[model samples]
Target: MSKTRCLLLAVMAYDRYVAICDPLRYSLVMNRGFCVRLVVGSWMAAVPIQVGQTYQVFTLPFCASHHLHHFFCDVPPLLELACADTFWSRVTLHAVILLFAVLPFSMIVISYVRIIRTVLKMHSAPGRHKAFSTCSSHLTVLTLFYGSATAVYFKHCSRDLADTDKYLALSYTVLTPMFNPVIYSMRNREVRIALRKLLWGK
Candidate 1:
C-alpha cells in the first residue's frame, strides 16, 4: 500500500512541478495522452521499486517470528526483527527511500517555496491575494504531509521521540489526504467558485 502510494505521489509531484514551472507549456508537454503515459510510467517504475523493497523486507535468513510493529508491517520494523545479516538490504532500502521517497517530497517543498516567493512579488493587492488563494491550501497540505512523514521516517517514535509521534503518523497517514480536498475546496477561490456555480445554477 505504501509502495503504491509512493509511486502515485511521485507522478503527482512531477505533474505539479511541470504545471508550476511552465503553465503555458504544461498542457502541451503533459497533455492528456502524455498524462496517461506518466501514470503508466509511474506504475512501471513502481514494479522495480516494490520488488526491491519486498526483497529487502523478506530476505533476512534469521529473523524471528514476531515481525509486526507500529500499527502495520513496514519494511524497517520487519528488518529489525531479523537476527541475520541485513546490513546490505538495510543500506539499500535506506538509500532507495532517501532517493525516491525523500527526494520528490523535497522537490514539492522547493516548488511551493518558489511559488510563494513569486506570488508575493505581484504588484496589486488583489493579484497577490488571488495568487495566494491558489497556493495556500497546497502549502498547508504539504506541511502536514511532510511533517508526519519526516517524524515517522526519522524514528521519532511515540515512546522514544515523543508521545505525539503516533498521532502525527495518523495525521499524515489518514487525515492529510482527507483534509487536502477540504482545504483546497474552502480556501481556493477557483474551487469554491466552481462549487457555487454547480450548486446555485450560476
Candidate 2:
C-alpha cells in the first residue's frame, strides 16, 4: 500500500505538471491508454520492493517480545524483535526507502517546481487561480502522506521507536487514506457538482 501510494502520487504530480505547464498537450499525453499504463506500471514497480521487504521480515528469527508499538506490521517494528544481526536487512530496507520513497518524492518536488513556474506565468487572475486550485489538492495530499512516511522510514536504524513515531505511522497508514477522498472531493468543483447532481437529480 505504501509503495503503491508513492507511485500513484508521483503520477498525479506529473499529471498536474502536464496539465498546468502544457495544457494543450495534456489530453494526448495522458490519454486513456497512457493512464492505464501508468497505473499498471505503478503496480508492477511495487512488486519487487514489496517482495524484498517481505522476504527480509520472514527470514529473521524473532527472539524478543512479540509486542509492537505500531498499529500495523512494518519493517521498523519487526526489526526490533529479530534475534540475529539485522545489518543487511537494514541496508535492504534503506534501499527500498530510497527506491520507493526518495525517488518518488524527488519526482514530485521537481514536478511541483515546474508547476509553480508555469502557474506564475499565467497573466489572468482566473487562470492562475484555476492552475493553483488544480495543483493544491494534490500537493496537500502529498505533503500529509509523505511527511509522516518520511518521519517513520528515514530515521536511523538504531534509533529507538517512540510512541510519537507510532502515532505518526498511524497517521500515515490510517488517517491519510481516510483524508484522501475528503481532500480531493471537497477541493474539486467538478466532484461537488457531480455529487450534487446525483443527490438532487439536477
Candidate 3:
C-alpha cells in the first residue's frame, strides 16, 4: 500500500516538473492522459520491484540467528539478515540498487534540478522568492527521505548492519513521511489559507 502510494506520488511530482519546468515542452507535455499513463507506469514498475524484494526475503539464507535490522522487511534489511556466504548477495544488492533505487533517484534529481533552475530564472524578486519557498520545501523533503536511505546504503550497510540500523531505517520510512507535509505545506501561506478555509467552512 505504501509503496503504491509513494510510487504514485513520485510519478505525479515528476509529471508536474515536466509540465511546469521543462524548457521546450512545458506547455505541450503531460496532458491529463499522459499524467495518468505516467502514474500507471510507476505502479507497473513498482509492483515488480516490490515483488522482487519479497522473493529475495523468502529465498535468502537467513538462519535463525540472522536478525532483521529494520522495522519492516525491506530489501536491505533482509540482505543484512543473510547468514550464508554473501558474495553473490552483495553483487545482487548493488544490481538492485541500480535497478530500483538509483534509477528513481536519478529521475528525482533531474526533475528537481530543472525545477530549481526554472525558479531561479525568474526575474521578479517576490515571484522568485515564492518559487524558491515552494521548491525549497519540496527539496527539503526529498533530501531527508533520500538522504536517510543513502546513509543506510553507503554508511551503515558499507560498515555492516546491526539492530541499531533499524533506527536509521525508521527515519527514512516513518519520520520522513511525518515531516514531509510539515516541511512542504506548513510554511506556505496559500496552503495554510486553504487549510483554514477547509477547516472553518468560510
lDDT of 2: 0.86
Worst 10 residues of 1 by lDDT: 156-165
Model 3 error, position 136 (Å): 2.3
**Backbone clashes under 3 angstroms, per model:** 0, 0, 0
Candidate order (TM-score): 2, 3, 1
**lDDT of the candidates, in the order given:** 0.67, 0.86, 0.67
Task: Predict model 3's lDDT versus the native.
Answer: 0.67
Error of 3 at 59 (Å): 2.2
Which parts of model 3 have CA positions greater than 4 angstroms off? 1-13, 19-28, 156-164, 187-202
Instruction: Tell me the tens digit of each residue's lDDT in model 1 across 107-202.
Output: 666766676666666678897676556556666766777777777677622346533655666787789888877886787568888888999968
Which tens-of-lDDT digit does each residue in 69-123 have in candidate 3?
A: 4577766666656776666766777776666666666777777778778877888
| True-vs-predicted CA distance for residue 83, candidate 2, Å | 1.2
lDDT of 2 by residue, 37-62 (tens): 99999989889888878987999998
Candidate 2's TM-score reads: 0.90
Q: Could you give me the TM-score of model 1 versus the true structure?
A: 0.73
